[model samples]
Target: MVYLAEFVGTAILTLLGCGVVAGVALARSKALAGGWIVVTFGWGMAVTMAVYVAGTTSGAHINPAVTLGLASIGEFDWALVPGYIGAQLVGAFFGACLVYLAYLSHWKITEDPDAKLSVFSTIPAVRNPVANLTTEIIGTAMLLLGILGIGANSGAVSAGQADLANLFTNGLAPLLIGLLVFAIGLSLGGPTGYAINPARDLGPRVAHALLPIAGKGPSDWGYSWIPIVGPVIGGVLGAWIWNLTGFGS
Candidate 1:
């Protein structure tokens, strides 16, 4: 059931995250060219909503990077890592499929394969592998760092700081985490659109290849490893640093 929660949560995450890209990038869409601010906010809100949906059941580790990070730090069970990641990937795939279905007519009319692709996956603005990988690494590192930090503080409600901890407890933690992602997008997303989660990028890219979308183009497998590898590396790094600091203890 917890695994199912992971699946549903990830599905919601990609559905709204990709939906925003479709809304902003696809030709003739009302929000076409809505710009980065809208995209960032939409994705942030998507995370918040998904967390609200699944946080109780699965802790809302919708991203594989996050699941792996927590497990690597001994904060989550190694036995459950594979199950969590599988659920997240499958959920993300279905979410991207939902996005495709939602904008069924936009594909052919959009005319730009690149624009269509962006709806399913991240694309580097400059297309430099080294730089793009670095950016993703930094972005995901910040994500895990912020997440663990928030988790650390969620205990404040029991630490004689109930009023001060209200923002991190009950239901507010999700919103703060969402804002963290938004800040990441605004600050570090330009380089590679911030593919900070392996499942978020891979599942949707795979869906793009498999789905019968008009002129969806190549899934760009060559660059896929960066988002997957960089996030894993960065996530582990962040978790280790947090563990070493023992802030949550």
Candidate 2:
């Protein structure tokens, strides 16, 4: 059940998140060129909605980085990590495919191949491998840190403290997480497009390569490893740092 929740949550996340990118970047859409702010808000809302739908069952760890981070911090079982990540990857792939279906006709009209690819995966503004990797690491580290903080706060509430527990419960954590994502996108997203989750990038990139979209350019496989590796490393580091703080206990 948990694995299924993760899969569905991640699929929804990718669907709406990438859907916004397609809406803005694809030709013949009313929101064409809706700009970065729109993309950021759309992704944030996607996270919020997905979490609302799946948080109770799976804690809404829709991203592999989040699953790994929680495990590293001893908040999640290491045994379940692989299944969670696998589900997230599968979900993201289907979600990207849905985006392709949603904008089936727009691909041919969109002249820029990079734009089409951008709807599925991120592309760096300046392609410096080291710098791009660093940016992704930093963004993901911040994400994990914020998530741990939210979880810690929720766990800190005493059993008898109903009011305090309610502050963290009943969907507050998910909402804050969405806002945190929005903030990250606004401030830290320019470099490497803030791919803080590995599954979020790789799964969709794979879909981009497989799907027959008109004028779709190369999947940019060379740059793919950075998003995957950097976020995993960052998630581990962030969780380790949070564990050291001992906030949740």
Candidate 3:
């Protein structure tokens, strides 16, 4: 059931998050070219909604990095990490598919293949591997750190207790998390588009490769590993730092 919640929550996150990109980038949409601020706010709200819906069941670790980071900090069981990540990936795939369906006709109208691809995954403004990887790592580290701070403040998930109600309802962690993501997107997203969550990037990128969208370009498989590897590294580092600091003790 917890796995199911993670899946559903991640799916919702991808659906709304990618959906905004589609609306802003796709042709004939009212939100076309709405700009970065709109995309950032949309993703932030997406995270909030997903957390509200799934926090009670799965602690709302919709992002793989979040799951891994918590495990590293002893907030979550390491044994369950695989299931959580798998569910998150599957959910993100379905969510991206839904976005494709929602914008069924727009693909043909949109001339830029890169734009279509952008809806599914992050694209760096400058494609330097080292720099891109560094940006992702830093952004994701910030994400995990912020999440740990939020959890500590809320007492939502103590050493052994994972109380969903306290996390979302009592502590308002969902709203704060949304704002955190919003801030990240606004401040640090320019480099690698701030793909702090591996599942958030890879699942949708896979969907983009499999789905039949008109004039769709390459899935950019060559650059896919950075978002996954960098975030995992960042998450672990963030959790390790938190533990060292005794912040969540």
Error of 3 at 40 (Å): 0.6
- What is the model-wide C-alpha lDDT for candidate 2? 0.91
What TM-score would candidate 3 get against the native? 0.94
TM-score of each: 0.96, 0.95, 0.94
RMSD of each: 1.7, 1.8, 3.7
- lDDT of predicted model 3: 0.92
Q: Each candidate's lDDT (Cα)?
A: 0.92, 0.91, 0.92
Candidate 1 lands at a TM-score of: 0.96
**Cα lDDT of model 3 by residue, 123-180, tens digit:** 9999999999999888888998898888777744455555564545545889999999
Itemize residue pairs with steric clashes in candidate 1: none
Off by over 4 Å in 3: 156-171
Q: List the residue pairs that clash in candidate 3.
A: none
Q: In candidate 1, residue 181 scores what lDDT?
A: 95
Better of 2 and 3 by lDDT: 3
